[model samples]
Target chain A: MKLHFSTTHEDHRIALLAALAISIYIIESAFPSPLPGIKPGLANVITLFTFLCYGWKIALQVSLLRVIISSLLLGTFLSPTFLLSLSGSLLSLGILMLVHSLFYPHYLRQYQPSAIGYAILASVSHISGQFIVAWYFFIPHPELFKLLPILMTFAVILGIVSGIITQHLINKLCSTHNK
Target chain B: MFTIGNILFKTTDFLILLSVSSLIIWLYSIFWSTDTLYGQAETLQVQYYNQVAIDYPLDTDRIIKVEGSLGSSIIEIKQGKARFIHSSCRNQFCVFHGWLNIVGDSTACLPNRVSIRLKGTLNPYDAIAGSQ
Candidate 1:
């Protein structure tokens, strides 16, 4: 498939989304986390918005580009942090796509998952992927698995928050475009 | 009305949220319930090369020297708490682990083949969950 941003409009939209996501990622990193691996993951808001507005292909592109470009800007490219981010993004995207397909079959494109469902699934999958990677490759300790409950709790809370924000943004955009 | 992908936030979405929240609560309770016995360790078991070396009551305040694969380790037990004060291992992970006052807490010095585990009936998990 032709994955390139085919038109100037498409390019502009992708660039805007990527910029928003990257900035959110960088800013979130500046905040102090109560725990080492706990963060709100606010950048996912833009990705979810793009997926709801556009489609999975563009959403995937935007999400991957955001992770790569943000990692490079933060000087974490090729580091363990970068690997974790990449793995989380990939896993979340895969789960989102699967859920999307399941909720909206090929013939029924109108019925898609609600924002809350998408966000919860994405967040849970993303954290699970990172936790597995950190436990097996980085720490290799049993104590790390003990942190799962706390992390999952945070994921659920942050997912709902970001999902609500994305839903609002999508609604505003749609209303404006309809006028 | 806020919506995304033509799907509105409806009663169905509320139901999903409620179910997910309950599931998370259940998991949290199972994993981190404070009702489980903690800080009630009755016995301290030391192992060398996967074999039991010594078992002692945790009520006393004393230091024990254990011989392992590499060299000797000094384990200190005080005020119902046990810890490795000194070990010949290079990493010193056991020493840095601070204390093992809980029923299921444990520490190991892989290089010296020495491990200490607290044993009690109310320990929640049989073994720490992790990839083999």
Candidate 2:
């Protein structure tokens, strides 16, 4: 017996976005790191953009695909790098979905998380999730806590930067799509 | 709409940004405080010529003298920070290495065969705990 799979429009969109993000991830990894284990994570802009435009379901799919595919391409699959990436993606996605469910409903629409809000939350959580997993499962050094302030500083700054980029993209593209 | 320069976002987005910024400040206060790390990450371990390293307390400012293969090396601990003040080594690389305050920080005077390492619970015990 043979099994067949059907693809939907949503699947195609997720794949396309994920491919874009994977390309960004691979390119970013090739650059020299000023500090070990720190990257700007520019690829996250794609995930944030998808979440803002399409909603959490598609965003989650895009994010997971990006992590899996990027790790496979970079030869980090099942390694510590892959685990850290997976944990960060899962955590950021979990929070994104949680926030979306709470606000994207009936009367809560007025205070809906804008692209900037979602981007900041996702990026900040992304770094922090990687930090905690590194501390617990891999390093476990208490001095690692010292780097947290610096790391979070980078995270917050990068979050704001990415948040602005995501907001700008939403302004340009989302408006065009809603019509 | 909340406008930052040219980019525009909702009031809620600005609020989220405000709260997250404050969170970074809070983390800075907790983990990056110089006052806390000064006394906590103590002791500088100095060694030479395959001899077991001796732990020198970083709390009291003092000059430590260690005998290396070539000549004596001087290490100074001031204000909970250690550095090689003078070394018999020709290159003077160890003295130029500057301050070593953080745990696991190390520098060596290769010609004199002398080395100094910052020792603390922050690294060794944690490594054992993690690998086990």
Candidate 3:
């Protein structure tokens, strides 16, 4: 006898968003990177959009699925690259959750972080987490920290670009929903 | 919301932007600026097995071979950078480390028992360990 599987709307949404992130990740990986940690991180546009629009539970689900599925698809599952991606995703989601909690109250609405703010925080935490893990496990050398500034420079720039794209997507999403 | 290029950037966004920029600049000043550790590296010290280390000035360009347990490792210094040109070790990690130009930077060929370190007037280990 075959066991029946059931799914919900939330599951479907998570799957769809994760698919988008994974496709972007695969395409991004196709390009040769000049440095190890520097990338456009265009896939982050989806994550930031999900966190800014959807609640934390859904955002976390989508982001985790994205990292895990994408690594498996790329054959990097359980490798150092996979570990770095997992750590980066976890830290980014953690920071976004914290930011949303702190800034989402009605009184705090004026200080609410826009997509750009969330994207920058996510990008910084993601790279910081990956860098720390890399230094600890692989290199464990002081000289490795020297690359942090350069990696962070890329993170900030890419974060802003992803943020703008995310804001635009959210705007388009809102208009269609209202209609 | 602050509008630039039709994007809704808010106060907190600018605040985060400023903070991250300053942090990156601060790290750059500490690590990548011209006057930091790389500027002070004046000597390359090579050690072979249990032998006393020999200091080579960075001003001159030359090649040196140090006898190791496995075999001799070839080293070259040119234009203020030092690197292992060849090593008998299979991994070639020391050679792969590329260049050593920072005052505290060091690399060792573990299998061959040869090591190289960049040094300056001030001993960083002495400063860190408080006695050396």
Candidate 4:
């Protein structure tokens, strides 16, 4: 099957992808909240769609470039906070990509459930990465593990919400007529 | 190969339940304990070393004192708030942390072996329990 991008032209498609990623990052970051880290991670939806539509290489590129640009644009460049955010994004993307490749085709009919499952897992991975880095550098303590369960509860709730949203958008965008 | 994602998803529901329960447990533990268990005031030690040396039995509400010899610094606190306001350490990160109020709030100058910390808890266990 010829991907839609072949007809859309290379430059236009690239621009579209970049715009989508930047928009996702900006929208997620702008919200002021008491919640420690509750980004919808809308950019992952773009990453997943691109992975399914184009290829893993492009998806990886999109995730990496988006994170780097977002960090620089957000004025967190080269800081530990930027590194923590990058690590979470990369870990989440890696988990999503792996899940998509192996179980996605087999569980196509259960896309919503699959999305939820993947979202929860990705959230855990992201949180774990951040916690590890934070514990090692910022707040060092073995007792810090006590904080994990509280964090996990929030991650599950937010993961389900983000996953449902992502799936809804993906289905709408990936429909035969929409593309 | 089963990735961490697979293991996590398989247990996501269970883990969420467990986390909720544990959070309740932690909260209960915090509120119900009769003794006030403080986090070690090591961090507060650094801030103490930056100011002038002080003697014991403090009586002021807000006092800041820093004291240290050539290689030893000690910040003594006798009141409500204290901090590692400054330090001669190489990094000087402790000096930047400023004031802290929590019991055992401290910063240390490792080179000087000096530590500063906020001393007492305003709401001690007896007061918290309304026994006093």
Candidate 5:
């Protein structure tokens, strides 16, 4: 049985992906933490999977669509703050695409790169994009470089947690498929 | 093909090492010296505010001290008038919005809902934070 039904199998795959992406965005926005601006990006895991199961093109499409859709739904479409999120997602997707290409080839069985790389890269890119947005928003003074280390620390911890969760899920899926 | 398990194990180990190293470095940077903490505090303040956004220019003495509220409001400072300081807000982020110790400059606090116009040093944190 095909676990992920494509358009040919379950034409609703796109919608399902979209719905899942929406949930991810909500979780990202609503879930507050002591460390400001940190997110698990649980939805990106789906993007990674799409990139692996399908191709980079589809993965990119899913991410872009999800971001735009979520931004619109959340009423942040035209706001500058929303732009930060868009940039982060795009940069993160770019990195994930690179990772997916390297690890999940056509001939691969039920394995992929360690979730650590994804977690780290995704987090780094996300924070990087955020910093860029911050740079533009703040402008002048040119004194914000001081916060990079602290932000990076937050990214590292969140990335580890997200990566571990993604890893567990992937393992579970593989095991389930085997059974 | 690299198995996912192997990749995960290796990445986990690497992350563990990296985290440990960073923790040690941060600790070293923290207790061992005041430079790192002060440096970080400066950075945090700047980044949190989107970098230094001076609301006034130098050489202006019109000072409008914001004593209450945490919101940015415009105020005109003259050559010899200075008033406005302290705020009810918890963070006092507005108090840090800026200072006008000169002749015609102005500073506004978004958090404290206050603005000060004066002619003096734009570097408010200079005296307190020192040498950033």
Candidate 6:
């Protein structure tokens, strides 16, 4: 017996991924951040996974849905934090697509980028977008620029961690599906 | 296939990413790090609510008091280093900043509207932290 849903398979898959991403986002937000603007951004793993498994379009849909739905759930809709998150997500997605198209095939005739490569590129662009938005719209201070190094360091660490996790999960899912 | 935990981990990809990240960090440090303090600060300038209260040489060991919006702040210059000793502000951020010996180091008691800035040959970077 198979379960029946109103939505198509593609819609169901996106909805499931969005739910997972939103759950991760909410859970991450519950934890206390060591610094004001620092976060693990673990939810990005889902986006990375979707991008690798499906394609850029599904990944983009999942990411946007996750951010908007999660922000609404967290009661941060239309707030400064929401704006920052939206900008970061959009910028990161753009960078991820660019890197995917440009480097995915050239380096080794591979179809797509390695998980770590995509993670690092997306994370760096995400943090940069957020920082630029925060500096321009919120703080507007040179002191804010000083946080770049610290933020980038955090981005690198988180990128590696999430990339490894996404790779492992994809391998597991793929192997099980093949079986 | 180079596999780590059943996943095809590419050595070339990892190396490329590592090099790129390191290069970025290196460039950032070169451009932003304040390790090379621009010429020695010859004097200290105290400002209260945007008004210049006093300008004094760092060669002397002395304390200067300046009144601000909230109350008075005591700035002490000793051993070519200057610091805020006391302020009426609840959070003593300025006082806690320890000392300012570099050309562009500064401390501000925002609540009290008092700021201490070093005066000398201006440096490209005012301050650099994290890359020790």
Best by DockQ: 3
Evaluate model 2 with DockQ and give the value.
Answer: 0.46
**Residue lDDT tens for model 2, B1-132:** 757676767888878889888988888788777544643567888888698888988899999988888899999999989999999978898898899987777888988999888877555322211210
Over 4 Å off in model 4, which ranges? A1-14, A52-55, A101-113, A175-179, B1-132
lDDT of 3 by residue, A93-127 (tens): 89888877887678887788788888999999999
Instruction: Report the C-alpha lDDT of model 4 over A61-99, residue by residue, as the tens digit.
Output: 777777788888988887987878778777877876775
Q: In model 2, how large is the Cα lDDT of residue A17?
A: 92
Per-residue CA lDDT of model 2 for A1-179, tens digit only, reads 99999999988989889999999999999999999867888899998888778877888889989999898899999999999999998898888888877886778877886766887889888888999999999999988888887887787778778888887787777754221
* Model 2 C-alpha RMSD to native: 8.5
Tell me the deviation in Å of residue A176 in model 5: 12
Tell me the lDDT of model 4 at A13.
63
Cα error, residue B82 of model 5, in Å, equals 36
Error of 5 at A23 (Å): 1.2
Measured against the true structure, the TM-scores of the candidates, in listed sequence, are 0.63, 0.67, 0.69, 0.52, 0.54, 0.66
Question: Which ten-residue region of model 5 chain B has the weakest summed lDDT?
Answer: B39-48
TM-score for chain B of each model, two decimals: 0.67, 0.72, 0.69, 0.38, 0.25, 0.65
Once fitted onto the true fold, the runs of candidate 6 whose alpha carbons sit more than 4 angstroms away are: A1-6, A104-108, A175-179, B27-32, B35-101, B104-119, B122-132
Question: What lDDT tens digits, residue by residue, belong to model 5 across residues A82-160?
Answer: 7887788788878777655655566642344466556767777777887888787754334565566677667777776
- Model 1 Cα lDDT, one tens digit per residue, A83-173: 9999899898898888677766565454455677688878888998898888888999755656887888899888888888777787778
Cα lDDT, model 4, residue A24: 83
RMSD of each: 12.4, 8.5, 12.3, 15.0, 14.4, 10.4
Worst 10 residues of 6 chain A by lDDT: A170-179
Model 1 segments beyond 4 Å from truth?
Answer: A1-7, A106-111, A175-179, B1-8, B33-132
Q: Interface Cα RMSD for candidate 4?
A: 8.2
Interface RMSD of 6: 2.7
